[model samples]
Target chain A: NAGVTQTPKFRILKIGQSMTLQCAQDMNHNYMYWYRQDPGMGLKLIYYSVGAGITDKGEVPNGYNVSRSTTEDFPLRLELAAPSQTSVYFCASSLSGGDTEAFFGQGTRLTVV
Target chain B: TQLLEQSPQFLSIQEGENLTVYCNSSSVFSSLQWYRQEPGEGPVLLVTVVTGGEVKKLKRLTFQFGDARKDSSLHITAAQPGDTGLYLCAGGRNNLFFGTGTRLTVIP
Candidate 1:
C-alpha cells in the first residue's frame, strides 16, 4: 500500500529559502507526524495532524508549519530555512492514536547552507 | 519533558559477540517499541512490547519491558555485521516519543 510516501528524497536549500516537504499515506491513517533526526540523536517532532483540518505543534516546531487538507496528505512547510534546519526528516502515519504501530517514509535529507 | 534515557549511546563489538542496550524512563508508558535504522533510511520496527514485563523474541534478538512500564531492554545474541544500525526505543502515547538512539556496529 506504499504505507507512507515522501517527496524529494534529498534537498539542498540556501538560507532564507522556503520549501514544503510533502508526505502522503495510503493506509488511511487518522494520525500523521513529521519528525527530524540529527546525527546520532533521537527524532524530534516537528508537527502532527490528528485528522483532516486539525493540526498541532510538537516538541520542535519552530520554523515549521503543517496543514492536513486531506486524509492522505500532510505537508510540512519551512518558511525561512536556516542551517539549524538541516537534518533527516521523516514522515509517519498510524491507523489510530491508541498504541498502533506507525509506518514511516524513507526520509528526506535536507541540507541548508 | 517526558524523556526516555538510553544507555551506551554507541556500541562497537565484534561478530558473534553478545550485547544489550537499555531504555529507561520515570514516566509510565502504554507501550514501548524498538526500531532499527540503517544509513539513509527510515527506522523500521523490530518489536513492540505492550504489557508490562512482556518478553518477545525475534530470532537472536530478545526484547523485554519493565514491569512498571518505565523501561525496556534489547539483547542481541551472537551479533552479526548485518546487525549494525541505529537502535531506537520509543515510548508510546497518542504519539510515540523516541529516546536518543543507540548506534551499534558489529565488526566482521
Candidate 2:
C-alpha cells in the first residue's frame, strides 16, 4: 500500500529560508501527525490533524505549520528555518485517533545552518 | 512538554544479556504504546497496553503498564545484536506524548 511516503529524504536550508516537508499515505487514515526527533529526544509532535481541513497544535508547534487539504496529504511548512529546527522529521498516520496502529515514514533529515 | 520520562538514557549489553528500561510520568493516560526505532529509520510499534497493570509480550521483549497508568517498563531477555535500537514509551490518544527514549546497544 506504500504505507506512508515522505518526500526529499534530506534537506539543507539556511537561516530565514523556508520549505515544506511533504507526506502522503495511501492507507486512508483519518489521523495524521508531524513529529520531530532530536538525538536522544524520542519525538515531539509539531502538529496533527484528525481529518481533512481540521488541524491542531501539539507539544512543540512553534516555527512550523501544517495543512490537511485531504486525508492522504499532510504537509509541514517551515517558515524562516533556524538551527534549532534541524532535526529528523517524521510523518505518521493511523486509521483512527485511539488505540490503532500508526504507520510512519522513513523521515526527512533537515539541517538548517 | 514531554510528559513521559525514561530512565538510563543509554545502555550497552553483551549478547544473551538481560536488561530493563523504565518510563515514568505523573499524568494518567487512557492507553500507552511502545515503539522501537532502528538507526537511520523511523520508529515501529512494538506493543500497546490499554488497561492499567496490563502486561504484553512480544518474542523476547516484555512490556508492563503501571497500575496507575502513569508508568511502563520494557524488559529484554537474551538480547541480540538485532535488538539494538532506541525504545520509546508514549502516552495519550490523539496527542501521543513521547518519552525521551532509552537507547540500547547489544554487542556480540
lDDT of 1 by residue, B28-95 (tens): 98888898999888888898899999999999999999999999999999999999999999865666
Alpha-carbon error at A21 in model 2, in Å?
0.7
Best by DockQ: 2
Q: State model 2's lDDT.
A: 0.91
DockQ of predicted model 2? 0.67
Q: List, residue by residue over A1-113, the lDDT tens digit for candidate 1.
A: 68899998999999999999999999899999999999888888778788999998878999999999999999999999999999999999988762677789999999999
DockQ computed for model 1 against the true two-chain complex using alpha carbons? 0.64
Q: Which pairs of residues collide in model 1? A: none
Q: Write the per-residue lDDT of candidate 2 for residues A1-113, one digit (tens) a residue.
A: 89999998999999999999999999999999999999777899899899999999999899999999999999999999999999999999988774677789999999999
